[model samples]
Target chain A: MIHRLIYPCEQAAKLSSRAMEQALTMPERVRLRLHLMMCERCTNFSRQIEFLRRASRKIPEVLENDAD
Target chain B: MAKYLGARFARCHETGITTRSISTMAEDDDLAQSLETHRKYLQRYAQFHLRDPSLAEDAVQDTLVAALSQRDRFQGRSQLRTWLTGILKHKVIDLMRSRDRALPPDAFSLDQDNNSAEGAFDAGGNWVDPPADWGKPDAALEASQFWRVYQECCQRMSRRDALVYSMREVMGLSSEEICKKIEITTTNLHVILFRARQSLRTCISKNWFGTQHD
Candidate 1:
């Protein structure tokens, strides 16, 4: 039933980024979960976003000691 | 001021600490050398965030001068670049705050075009075009080529968008702080961030990861 109530991918993507910055409402969270369950592409997109966020945090660390 | 720099150099000698009896003049030379070495990186770092070459140059030049005069305060534990960046961060914030005053009343034109995450879904809120698997992405982060392509993508974005993105992602500033620095509303910053991420994703996928990034 949850999967059947699929939220749109655009909404899912928006919620996905918002989730990084702050808490998502329960309904928002549930709908996004349902959408992700039904969509591999959204899941992939979400993971890619998380990866970028994490990588960004590491940039200074990478550049700090560079002899250049 | 030149007078202040002169005072700092004079004080360098007054320390009279036996351990550092080595000429303060020598330490001064080292600071000058290191500051010059890091100039390009510092300039690029500022330019990358400010998206204005002249302002970036101004911030970097000030940062170098400040670092030079305050050389005595630098503890040896951290890398010099890291220390310089710490100082540069403050300088950039100061420059941006002042620069905001000169901005036109309509500086941050809300780019409504990107507000809609277009083609991301259908009217019913379901995926019309879904994202593709990026495979294992960890390996790509270590690839120098990936960084080159990522920098190109950033450089290609509009000035304001690039500034907002760099402030958030590269500088790791909080969204609220970024809003205050750039003087934009939170919603506008989010839209800009989303657009930046979308463009970066497209660029990365097409150039580095796979095709169809566009």
Candidate 2:
């Protein structure tokens, strides 16, 4: 029997959506955690999402404070 | 005594955090100070969302006027900032929609080739090069400079594209809700977001990253 990936591509995309909000449903959360345990690519993608979030936050603060 | 305690607890639960109570409490505070605080944040939030300093100032003033007029309706369930931001968002949408109507047919040609949409990293998942250190003694200065460039690039985008990107990436709105608010299909939303990001990325590279020849 083929061992199906815990989170398939479409489901992984949904997981990414939840991950963007840093909120995941119980079952989806479990599946994402399980997948991340075995998948390096997904793990890297998660890190990228987090980096993007942090980087974006700086833009508004900077614009607001600019003297020029 | 136990019965009296239970009754008190039930009453406390029953009367929990009503909008009327919060509004009354808010009204009892320093109105001027509260309005000033709202103005400061609203100015910043509007600047970020609208990317036009003059427009942002106008939006902040408008938000204050509206909020003051609607003070009686403020239940205080949400933070004042959130409430003010909601007002500014609506104002921005109105502004953009009106501006869209005034544009000529060819004013917004969507044919520009956006080359930066692909991953900034290579196969090894490393940035083409680590971001350059500006060699500024003050980290804050470096950060501020980069942010100015970022803001400028974001402002260059069309209003619809910028709105989609800001709502999705910066504000963290879900795609479905963004689609509903922006009145576009999911595919169109994705394309807009992709193009917006690509434009921003290219702009940042050109302005901040310096050229390969440099």
Candidate 3:
């Protein structure tokens, strides 16, 4: 029963990244949560992609200031 | 030349020029030159979102033309590049919309998720090389060097992937909006985004975060 609830790291990573753009379904959310609870690397992967999104928004300003 | 200056002066008075410097012509020349300086950077930026080189060039051209025509409105409150980018952003979006409408249904040729995992996973869908710890992410934001590295990683993506990624993340466009503009389904959009994020994560980890498993 517990095994069925667990998503592999690849699926967990995809769900975590997808969660940023759209709301995951209840089952997806639940399974991803369960997977994340046990998976340290996937949790870190989720956090890094979130960080990437936030960082990306500032790119225009960064490029502007880079001009001579 | 004197007749032209006289006409310009009369027009300036008629339009109620509030902040006219002594040499309006020279200032106009300077503004043109300055706008030209940022053209390459603007092209790079537009290409990152537009995917087609000609479309990107046309968008930048339209932006400069609009900027010059509305030179009076530039209050100099922001940097010149920032101001030009503000204009270019709109021009790029307008081009994207119009071009999407003009293209045939078969024009897009959106690739499937071909290189998504790129051997990151094994047959059982398990991680071949799992993600490593990235300490203190917020601190990296303060380092300009880190941003340069980030820019490099972004440039390393395929053109279509970069376009979709920039649309979603940088331009703050919604998934629905991107799907409509690019003529792609939400599922395909997710695949492109997933690939982009995965590649960027690996690049940043290898370059900036130092993949030392602690």
- Report the lDDT of model 1 for residue B167: 74
What's the true lDDT of residue B115 in model 3? 43
Q: Write the per-residue lDDT of candidate 1 for residues B1-214, one digit (tens) a residue.
A: 3454456666766776345646766777677777777887887778656768998988987888788867778878798988899889878877876776678857756757546554455666565545678888898777776776777877776666766776787788888988887677877777877777777776777778874332
Report the candidate with higher TM-score, 1 versus 3. 1
Q: Report the C-alpha lDDT of model 3 over B5-47, residue by residue, as the tens digit.
A: 3455467667866576658867876777788788888988887
| Order of models, best DockQ first | 3, 1, 2
Model 1 misplaced stretches (Cα beyond 4 Å): A1-5, A61-68, B1-30, B50-55, B69-78, B93-107, B111-114, B118-129, B211-214
- Model 3, A25-53: lDDT tens digits are 99999899899899999988999999999
Best of the two (1, 2) by TM-score:
1
Q: CA lDDT of B202 in candidate 1?
A: 68
Enumerate the candidates' DockQ scores in order. Answer: 0.59, 0.10, 0.66
lDDT by residue for model 2 over A1-68, one digit each (tens)? Answer: 22454644333533554555445678777777777686665554455444444667555555456554
The candidate maximizing TM-score is: 1
lDDT digits (tens) for residues B109-211 of candidate 2: 4443332234444554343433333333223334656566767888887777787777887766778878787577765665566556545655665676553
Error of 3 at B82 (Å): 7.3
Return whichever of 1 and 2 wins on DockQ: 1
In model 2, the clashing pairs are none
